[model samples]
Target chain A: MDEKSTINKDSENIERGNNIEVWEDVVNIKDLLLSILICASAAMGGYLIAPDDPQKPLLYGLVGVVIGFLVSSMIIKPKRTLRFEDEEK
Target chain B: MDLSLIMELIAISIFGAVLYTIIGIAPGTDETAVLMPVTLILVLSGLQPISVLAFFISSIVAKKLTDSIPVAIAGIPGGVLSAPMVEHAMVLKNRGLPDVSIRKMASGSVIGTLIAVPLSLFLANLLIPFGETISKYSNEIFFGGAVFLALMTKNRWLALLSIVPFALLIQGLRHLYWGTGAVPEDTTVFTSFFLGITVGPIILKLLELLNKEIRSNLPRRTTNDIVLKQQEKVKGFPNPFKILDKKETGSAAFSSVLGVFTFFMSPAGMTIFLGEVISSRIKDPIKKATRAISSMDGVTNAAYISGILIPLIAIGAPLSPTALGPGMALFNAPPVFTEDHNLHHILSMGDFIVATVIGAVIAISLTYFVTVKYSQQICTFVFKYIPHEALLGVFLALVIMLAYMDAGLINIGGVILIGLVAGVLHRWGVNYGIQFMVLYAAPWIVGNLVF
Candidate 1:
């Protein structure tokens, strides 16, 4: 009976660990997807608004893409966490 | 200034003070929303330049002072500028000392204004000689200010990086509007952008209610009873000096002076920055919190006043974010006070100085009286009768209406899109200051880089 209980506990621990990993992965995916959407939409917006000049549209679009990449990277890798407590103190 | 103009100034100041006090009492009403429309009306109505200046200055002062009431008692910020006071005020509220907190804020505002006026006037006079030179490099100045503001945020690199996307977003919208063969008013377009950003977080939270998972995880109010300290009523007019301790008074004055020099920075940023600086030097948490709250209020008033006064008196342009945002009408009221023919051109330096001082004095006096005597009753009334959802609904409706008025149907869509983007960034701790800087610099960035 003791041996059986130990085996069940080990399996439960593994299941919990797997759940945590899955949750983290989901969060990361959400972040990446949001970033891409923000960037793509911004680029599309620039392209749509640019004048009829062939080169200008492409250049504006490229600038938008660069901007999007920078924003997304920043979102993905935040430099520091903000705390309300810090301001209060 | 003439005698009739002086009388008109005083009358306008009083009217503005009373109107803004009521508006400031209600949470969710932004200074820009109130100031812009009213100033535009006054300007279009053919009010004298001194009268308009007096009205604008007094209204802003009164609003900033009374904004503390909602922040202290109910833990709801009166507006974006007042949001920083929530945490510190909440500390005092939980301790059943909200009365003390309100008193400190009110006193801080009054004292801060008293000290900032003369100093700012002096600085404005000194800076006036360089205004012409500065205007030439306004584009560079805006870019530098944007970069500096981003670097000062909590997540400096993230903020700096986000600026690129934000600026692109703004420029894209501008270009799109222009492409339609429509002459878009810069003020109207920017106003829509401002409203969108201001209401972004609320819109996001409202949308979250549609998701069951998010809704269930959200914190709900568990109680409605707001317990406040019941102090004995003191007779006659309340003195600010008596309410604030010597050390607290000193800090408030010092921070106010410092905030005057940073008029180009966002008022919200200055409040938090000054509060943190002051609080970090103190040892005890409770004492630190109290001092920080007072000085933060001080910074809010001082920064706002100096921001408007300095720019108007020195540069005759909306150089500071405060001037460009809430005080925009004073600089660029179409058909009446265009950018070139603004108050700076019409009013003399003597008129500016006298009107501002008179406006500040009367406005602060009235606000201080109302705030000190009836703050508790006001808080109790708002909390007991005013529904939070109702306030949110009204504000949302107002913003939408304003956006539609600004640029018809297309702006409404633009406002929502901008709101969504800003909402995401704000939730991640990117502040309005950085956003404002980016918006202001967007034209320059696009002109130099893309075109």
Candidate 2:
């Protein structure tokens, strides 16, 4: 009985490792966290290091957000796989 | 006014149109969250006000046109406003007419933009004389709007019950900031709180994932496959009238008028209400669905335009829901635009008209054409390439950065706390419109609360 329960627990762990939905799209939790980390650091880092000029910080932050977005896009593959089907008729 | 300025306006309009068309097709992107950060940045960057107006108008038009693409392509809403059309869009998708659904919706957007622009300008002018009275009672009006929207919600009781507590929570945070000297008493922590509300659901969901029991129990799937039907390419520039039949056009036009009239109401609510009322009598499911989607798209687009335009042209404050949300930057981005000094004060009537015309025309020409011609291809590309992680990352970064900018590090924690509470309220059916109204009326509600 103990052996059987261990096997069941192993199967549940595998299931828990799979993709989960967020904001109407499937995503791996690890990737989500990584992307968030990269982006938050980039954006905040840009904001922090900028000269005290009001516009400079915001502009740098905006650029940082874009950079983070591009980096994340290159690093993380989208969970969705698309398949196309021609019209039968 | 000048040739160089007109040239700059045209260029920015194109930029706005191109940028939003892609963003609009990404599923589940909230209208405000994606639109506001960039707009806020632009405003704070000290760009020309006329140019900003042009960009905003174009962005709205482009976004409205393409947000329905995902609904037609994959049966998921691209934004909150597109959620209402999903049922009807699914109808057409199931009927093997996804392209048709997209074309109809895009055409409907064209009609909406066309009708809404002049009519909104005219209506704004008509109300300009009353702008004084309106701004004087703006706080009371916002409070009343919250109550009215609460009453209209599905869970009216829960929504109504949330108003006072939510108000207290907002004002409580503000008072704390003032007392601790995190910010001056007069410098309201607006932007971060606004971003916090937008990020609420995500924050809640992220926190829930931290619980082992919840994490283990979440339903998981190995493959998240999206099947796209092969669509025949349109050879020429598609005309809006050609895409929509007479009955569809008429209903869309009629709904667009109603959308303008109900400018102060929630666009999503207006879309569902008007879409259903207009299409209820039709017998055929496919026909009914098409009609409904066409008119629904029209209502949202019209409501969006008028929502921003009317309040902007009439009152300098963020009075309407659109103004309060995505268009807030135009009305009240601090140090640049305040309630007292915004587009309404800065731009003349001619400037408004010129900016509106340039933005609307460019967006319609560019986005409408692309939507009819290549919605499937572009949607497939976005789905295949743009990870949800990246989008969510950008959203997260925006909120955190803005929170830090508002009152420093402590305000970040404050924003998250606000997000948690707002997320719970959101999950419980207190809609953004109601929450936003509460945000606007918080100081008033707290100050006027009787012992």
Q: Best TM-score goes to which candidate? A: 2
- Backbone clashes in model 2, listed as residue pairs: none
For each candidate, the DockQ is: 0.02, 0.44
Docking class of 2: acceptable
The lowest-lDDT stretch of 10 consecutive residues in candidate 2 chain B is: B221-230
**Model 2 spans with C-alpha error above 4 angstroms:** A1-16, A87-89, B1-5, B22-48, B69-102, B245-247, B272-293, B332-341
Q: Tens digits of per-residue lDDT for model 2 on B333-356?
A: 888998788999999999999999
Docking class of 1: incorrect
DockQ of 2: 0.44
**Best candidate (score: DockQ):** 2
List model 1 lDDT by residue over B1-451, tens digit each.
Answer: 5788778888889998998898788666777766777777677778887888889889988998888887886666777787777778878876667677888898999988988899889999999999888767776777787688667778888878887788888878867777773435443278878888887776675565557787556543222334556666756998988988999999999999998998877777678777878888888766887899889988888889998999898998898878888889889877788879998788888988899988998898898898988876776566544544334434554566556555656777888888888888887878776677777778887777765
Residue A34, model 1: lDDT of 59
